[model samples]
Target: MQTEYRYITESLAINDYGSGDRELVSVNDGPGELDELFQRVGFYSASHDFRELCGFIRRFPKIGPYNALLLHIQRPGCTFVATAKEWKTDFNRTVKPGARPLVILRPFGPVNFVFDLQDTDGPDPFPEDLLEPFKIHDRSREAECRYALDRLLNAVPADGIAFYPSDFSTAAAGYIETAGIGSWQKFRGHQLKVHYNHVVSRNLPPVEMFASVLHELGHLYCGHLGTVDKRAWPDRKHITDAGIKEFEAECVSWIVCSRMGIDSESEKYLADYLDQNSRIPDISLEVILKAAGMIETRIKKGIPVPKSMKIS
Candidate 1:
């Protein structure tokens, strides 16, 4: 698809999706939502110390991300954990007779319990690699990460939402830029308003830019900024607590970023946010994952969303 717009001095009109090298294409598939496991894990991941949690994820690459997080919360500072059978088979060790077990969700069956290596009787047979924090000595994700961000931004859905770069400060990365309070999109023949336009900072890297846009979109899509169309999104502006809005948006950003293997600052930001508060905010897990799934499906391919070309 081809879109054209001239960059103005103060305001930008980014009607274009590509710069000759890349172009947008339309798709017929609908977006997806996170499953129940992710729905629960995603919430916990956001509120906790995810930077350290990510370390656990790195240390235990075999366990899934959700399981890693579960292990981190249930047992902090745990270097390695394994099932009793795995300990006996993989490391030739055995769990103590009655060592307390840590629980993790099992995808196919009931919950499972794991024993930490310290709780097991082993001869310390691990090589240096197993003892040290696993690091990629031969390669890095720099190139793939850059491409992921580009692909993410380029796959922006065309649902009356237009993204443009702005001179936003370091304190603020980006924000929603609408024509007015009730912006409308003209689709087929009908015209209706939507509050989905965005403005990201030009100074940010691909990850930061993608994250900034998602944060802003999260606010609008999650109905923190008042929903003009309840059918498209909900109307949750009644949630007067600003922390709740920020929490939900960061959760969306963290989930999507984690999916792409790009560690975003949302982990740090959300962790810090919780440190200053006494209790966790009342957030909607369903909405957060729904928003994340929508963004995820859009970035999967160059798909034109069900939107209109006319905006007013």
Candidate 2:
């Protein structure tokens, strides 16, 4: 039996996390309307992904995803940013007099003002490799693929999800099963634990291998595997339709891969399914988009060290 967790809100709100000029509005429109609205999530328009969203995300890995986006909205070319105090103490840099500070929402606190590297004058104290590890650059096509696979392998252990080697290479490349919690991850509302085993093959191209992990993560984020922490994402495990699960995951794979400039075969899989059914499967467009956004944010720079692993 799956737990009936608090799922995606039936109602959608189109407030720009403080970046939009328009006032917030509640969208009570059905799937079609909200579906259209969700795609319009770009501060400017839907086609904005061709711009700097991914680069902005990769450049500011220290801030929470929402705040990083807020920073990008306020200043698109922002480099390293630190609080006035942090700039002075950690970086030995001082904010230039009269430099207007950029604001980001402080976690559990009021707003915080942080100065970008451009606004600061300081003795360079960072090691040569300071952010080199977190940057997004490709040495070659093959290197990018290898990095994708390696990053996913290293990144999953943070969430208590372990991946093992496999021989198969298609999207059904792996299986996910509960491993029974070996330990507790950082508790949010309550003590939450995940011991998930995902198996994927290394025989495929890097892009295909990467999409396979994305496909599997699609299931976890969609609540098909059940929720370890609803605070991170809603758990809709009670949605017991196999087709819905596959459809949602496929949609997520398509959405994330498209944004990352990687082509996915999931598009063909989805198209074939739709053509055969002659109608869209009953899947939550909201959840599918949300899952893609989450995954893309994490991988936009590269595989990210989860928030849990960040401070652990």
Candidate 3:
């Protein structure tokens, strides 16, 4: 019993040990019973396989992290010799077992002893629907950003002004009408219409275009337009309100672009905006993060957005 207790304690220590210590301890006893045990429990192999298994397990929302790990390693009908409460609460299956208990770490709580696959049924959880919504095709960051941008553009509401390639003599790279008669004509309800200058679009890289579109979309989604009166659109206060609106939009663009691995001038833009007056809005960080997540999800799902038939 004392030997069993020591073994159990050492096994638990493996989880907390550094890589060197773990490897040393696993091999120090000279490749006998413990080595075989490590192999059986999946501690002997490279982490790549474990990572893949974890990725697969993460896709299933019904399974908890600990349960997922156990399901990955534990075999069917394995005996789980945990406490009665653990047996009742954690284990899905219970069977009579006469063999000695096998000490295995529980997914949660303290260390406990379990028997073998024959004594208890193990979990076999999987994604409910085989079809995953967000199937990203482009592996490169720039390509992915462009793809996401295209999807977002195509999803603009019908009432929103259609984006078109247009040659503008002015230096502006893009424009969005947030207020005034132009806004009333272009915006539908909450949707904001944006247009990119063809000269700038053609000159800039696809990633830049992605950044530009995301910045514009950030303005629309952040409720910047709704904050101002349509008649009093482009108000000086709105543009320079301690860089509130611009900072918010640029930050959104920066986050989304960064996640997609696209380099952006959003930081520079934010710096310039902040130069006007160093202050950020009281906007919720959760709101910005959630919005970025939603946008990325929409992009990955390949939500169809019709091309603008009207060319300028």
Output the lDDT of residue 59, model 3: 38
Off by over 4 Å in 2: 1-142, 168-172, 183-194, 301-312
Per-residue CA lDDT of candidate 2, range 1-312, in tens? Answer: 011010111121223221111111122223433344334542323223312454465445456444555566567777678899998888888889999787665533445789888898877865434444334544234566566556555555655666777887454567677776454444333333446878787677777777788899889866777655554456677888898899889877766555444556886786566546544655665455556655654443333234553333
Question: Each prediction's Cα lDDT score?
Answer: 0.58, 0.58, 0.44
lDDT of 1 by residue, 1-312 (tens): 011101110111121111111222112112112223434345334434434544455566445444555566567778788889999888989999889887654433445689988889977675556645334342234565567656656655355565668887666788885556656654435454454677778877666777777788777766677654444556677888987898889877876665455667886786677676544566765466446655655555554544343343
TM-score of each: 0.51, 0.51, 0.40
- Residue-level lDDT for 75 in candidate 2: 72
Worst 10 residues of 1 by lDDT: 1-10
Compute the lDDT for candidate 3.
0.44
Provide the RMSD of all predictions against the true structure, rounded to 1 decimal: 14.7, 11.1, 19.1
Count of residue pairs whose backbone atoms collide, per candidate: 2, 0, 8
